[model samples]
Target: MRTRAAFGRVGYMAGALALSLGLLGGCSAPSVSTQTGGPAVAPAQDRDALEAQIAEVTQALRALGPGVDPDEAARAARIAVLKPLDWAREWQVVDAPLVHNVKVVNGFREKGVCQDWADAMEIALHAEGFRTLDIHRAIANARNIKLEHATVIVTADGQPWDSGLILDPWRIGQGRLYTARVGEDDRYSWESREAVRAWTREWKARALAQQG
Candidate 1:
């Protein structure tokens, strides 16, 4: 009986080993190790491609901006000055407003806060390489309301300066240029806002220097 029991135990041990092997085989595949030290990450090629695309788009946008219109591009040299500057963020010293106050709301400039808008325009013109002319004539439609109205006539060609006041910003549109040049009696008029026109050397020496 003891010998029979030993044989039975051996058979049982063999069966147990076979079952263990079968169970391990049923597991089928090995799991990829994702523990403390896993596989190396693939380089982020897609991320770099996206960044490169963004840079190209930005360059395209900047290239589109400096386009010239001959008439319009002429003001590129000075538009930076009259542009609505962020006084609060950049130039706290001057305190220019983000929005300009011209005609509608009785702007600080219109109400005589930093020189009548005309004088301010003249100063800007002078600074922007422009000169001015004061019209004391009895022209039918032109007027100054209070003072002898002065306007910046465009004389780039040195023609006989026929009060064709070429205020520059108006050049942005031919309509604006047309209207600013022809005022009340079909004569030309523009409030001396930031000048679009400039003065020649001859006029600069005479009009502005002799004023004050």
Candidate 2:
């Protein structure tokens, strides 16, 4: 009794619903980081591994500068590594990032895309209000809509953006955090988020003028 278009809409909704239910049933919550003052939610083996990573990240942040506060470094490292994992679990990210992007686009998931990861990380770190550390937002492949990527960078306060450390969780997927110095990252040439936004605005204006 339904038209073909009506039947297609119904089928799409049903598919999305099924995917959401499957994700909920399959993904388990990740353990909270010890530095966050919460009991571990993971098994003993996984908990040990996560703790080791937190320590490593802490060391990396401290090495950024002699003036970097030890306490601030430890806190930043803990949030950088653990927050994304928590988000991944909540978003039920069971596939690679791009694959999960499809899920989000189709309404099978709420949020797990690269931009979402970057935005979440930046917000969490900024909340710490570190006096010895600075947070930056960056974009890669800004001219290519299909390949554009966003990430959060952390640097010693008063240091240049290029000298900072990159905190990216969406690259490897499943909430596995990746960190590297800005100069060491060979995959993408990063640009300041503000610069990219200004360029985008100018580009749109040019396009509109040409069409007029």
Go through the candidates in order and give the clash count of each.
6, 0
lDDT digits (tens) for residues 31-101 of candidate 2: 21112122213346787788898999999899889989999999999998788878887888766555566
Off by over 4 Å in 1: 1-73, 76-115, 130-150, 166-179, 182-212
lDDT of 1 by residue, 1-212 (tens): 56988998657655654443343221111221112221122136644643453344333222223431233223422231232121111212121111111111222223321123333344544555422222111121123232223333333232334433333221111111111232331323343332322323546777778996
All models, RMSD in angstroms: 33.6, 8.3
Highest lDDT against the true fold, candidate: 2
Query: Which predicted model would earn the best TM-score?
Result: 2
* Candidate lDDT values, in order: 0.29, 0.78
Error of 2 at 85 (Å): 1.4
Off by over 4 Å in 2: 1-43
